[model samples]
Target chain A: MVTIPFIWIMGDLLWNGWDQLSFSFVFSAPQNAGREGGIGPILISTLLIVGVCMGTAVPMGLGTALFLSEYTRHDHVLGRLIRGSLDVLAGVPSIVFGLFGNALFCQILGLGFSILSGGLTLACMVLPILIRTVEESFHAISQEQRLSAAALGLSKTTTIRRILLPAALPGLLVGIILGLGRAVAETAALIFTSGYVARMPESLMDSGRSLAVHIYDLAMNVAGGNPHAYATALVLVGLVFIINVSSSWIASRWTSCNRLSA
Target chain B: MPFSTFFFFTLRVFLVGPLLWAWAWEYPSARAEGERLIITGSSTMAPLVSEIGKRFETLHPKVRVDVQTGGSSRGIADTVNGLADIGMASRALKSQEQHLNGSVIAHDGITIILHTSNPVQELTDDQIRSIYTGSSTNWSHVGGPDSGITVVNKAEGRSTLELFLDYFHLSNRDIHAHVVIGDNEQGIKTVAGNPNAIGYVSIGTAQYDAAHGIGIRLLALQHIPATLETVREGRFPLSRPLTLVTKSPPAGLVKTFIDFAQSPQVHDLILQQYFVPLQG
Candidate 1:
């Protein structure tokens, strides 16, 4: 039943967009409100937005997960408080985050409607999910490993660097991939933050349209924009598929290498 | 150990490389800042303004025009707050917003639509209100077949919905919609597919789609035909101007861009988007 919807959507996209997909379609700037030309600028903007999101989210998520798993007991008041807030944040609608981001990042911080603000907003939205996933991965590590590291006279930081991190690498990769998927597919949060400009971004401060936003505008707002909208959607789906497949491949290769070393 | 080290090294490079590249690109542009005009507001007017901005950019090589869309209210707010060089509002500014200067570029009309298969040729204002409010659920109640009427309404936050409500003297809460749609095309599609469905959408979009044999019909209002000619003549009761607003009198690049937008050179572009250019 689940696969039926997926197949149906893929078939529809291919049926409508296959002829329109070309090298120029992916590499040229959009003209006439996306009725013609390609999505080159939009592609770069999506990449930069996702890159900024991952760059900020990974470090913060990793640190928070480590602190939650290693620096405090499971029942510690502060840890519990942080966990509670993260859980709540994970459930909050993305539109709320978009509004908050617009107020804080775009207005207060003077980032204006730029890729930086959009990326920062996406980072905030994905952090809770990333941290929870990574923390669970950390907790899944056996206690015997920690005891063995302690018996080896290793410091807490050393134990984390060598033992916990390597052991939990798959989970960390999963967390990052999940966060990337969310950041790339986001539309509501980005529309108000990164904004609606379809120009090629020369810098982080320039407003550039993301692929999802382009698809949205072409599909809903622009009259007779369906052909290009379908093509853009097909490209987005292809991107998500590639990200998922490559992440799983990397996870498997890393695990096999670790087993060989052990 | 070497494998893990290599992996972390690659990861670090992946994360930090983009940041470094972004900063490097920013440096040269920062030193040589060019003229940038930011236009924000009204999703309805955004596509047209974007096309105009593109032509404007080609004419002025060094200048950049950035267009953003949220809604008409956002356009007003952004303009008043000085965040935008110009704001695009599809409707005229209210009395309180009169402080801002508004220049009309085009006109768009909202029209009632039905499936062409529907036998009802016309409806009075009272009939439409009754049908929308659920007081009249059958087409027979409004001089049509005895089948049930499906009311297709625009979703909340859509300017179309707001305009619809304003023209009909009805609030959103009073609407008993059978199907809520997001855009003009969607509403037209829904009504086209359903023999008994009635909806309202942009007259230009409806006319284009109907001409292309989309199985939808545009209904006249108050005995006047629902045609582009009527709208152009300013006889359409439910029409709104596509306006460009500024906090202060436009000067410099902003003034030049607005003038170019209103000039006859872009009338074909305006007509191409299915909006009526202001007649000289």
Candidate 2:
């Protein structure tokens, strides 16, 4: 029953977006708000934002997950507090994150409307999920694995670096991929933070538009850009699909390779 | 299908759900409304129409009044197609739209708005033009702080943008805006957030928000204030007629609605919506 609606939507995207997704449409900056030209800047901004968000999120998420899982007792007050906070943060709506990002980065930090502000906002949004999932992955790694490394006379840090991390690698990748998905799909938080200007960002401080915002602009506010909006959606869906398939494939292969070597 | 494929399919479906509904749902007509007067058009004039509609409905209890907003273009199109009894337009009718009769109901204008914390109280006409055209880039360059000036512009399909472009003698492509926002509130919010930002929006909207402590100030153009009194007194230079457009000269319920909209009874209502009434 659900598949029927799902197939119908895919057909619609193909119908609306097929002819409009030309080479120049994917490669050139928009002219007339996607009425005449293309979505080049939007694509670049999306990549830059996702890159920055992931770059910040991965290190912070991994470090926090490692500390909470390894250093603290299960019920440590601070750990509980951190976990509780992460849960609450994950529940916070994206629009609230947009407002917070506007206040902190755009106004207080004086970053203004730029890709940097939006990237930071998405990083904060993805952090909660990344930390939770990564922590669970660490927990799922058998305690016997850690003990085995300890019995081999390896120091705690060395054991963690060489053995524990390697065994938990697939799980950590899964967490990161999930965060990547959220970052790529995020729209509301970026709306206020990233100024919706359809031009190539000259610097990190320059405001840029993402595909999601561009699509919203073209589709909603007026009539002339409807065709372009549908085409942009098709491109966005295709990009997300490639990211998901490749990342999960890499994780699965790495996990199997580790098992065989062990 | 695999779980991943199904999950991905579901996500795409969810995203397109609204589009599907829009495509499937039939456009509502006056016939569908039943004993109601359907008004459609610019979002700017929507609130005023509803206010007047409520008053008219009370005066004639049997007739229900419904107002919907898409934009001015939708207004003209709906009226031409007989989908609406009256179309609310925030700008004067273009020459191509001569077939429809547009009655001037009130007046409003696009005016420059700045954050209350901004030091520059006003700007010269040339400076305002330069700022929008990318000639003036920094606030300090324009008698303000050292921060770069953020220019917030209206989106396409808005009458405010149309009036702004016409008044300044600038093309849409000439606007070097840092942000493009839809509707008056978004423009006000953008200006309120940035200390060095300037935007053009309806003067009435700016005045109303300023009174409500929204932390934005409307800058005088050519040294004439953009207050309600000034707008009424014909001192505001960037003003546009707020018109009630009908496909042809209105009659029956449509004519009554138009007459009521332009009458003295809605003067307070117009003033409350931040518009200058066309008459005493």
The candidate that achieves the highest lDDT relative to the unseen native structure: 1
- Kindly report which residue stretches of model 1 are placed more than 4 angstroms away from their true locations once superposed: none
Candidate 2 CAPRI level: incorrect
What lDDT, from 0 to 1, does candidate 1 have?
A: 0.90
* Model 2 CA lDDT for position B62: 62
Can you tell me which runs of candidate 2 are displaced by over 4 Å? B1-280
As a TM-score, model 1 comes out at 0.96
Taking the true A–B contacts (Cα pairs closer than 8 Å), what share appears in each candidate?
A: 0.54, 0.00
lDDT by residue for model 2 (B68-115), tens: 555788788878877678888899999999988999999987789999
Against the unseen true structure, what C-alpha lDDT does each candidate score?
0.90, 0.79
Error of 1 at B50 (Å): 1.0
Docking class of 1: medium
Winner by DockQ: 1
Query: List-wise, what DockQ does each model earn?
Result: 0.64, 0.02
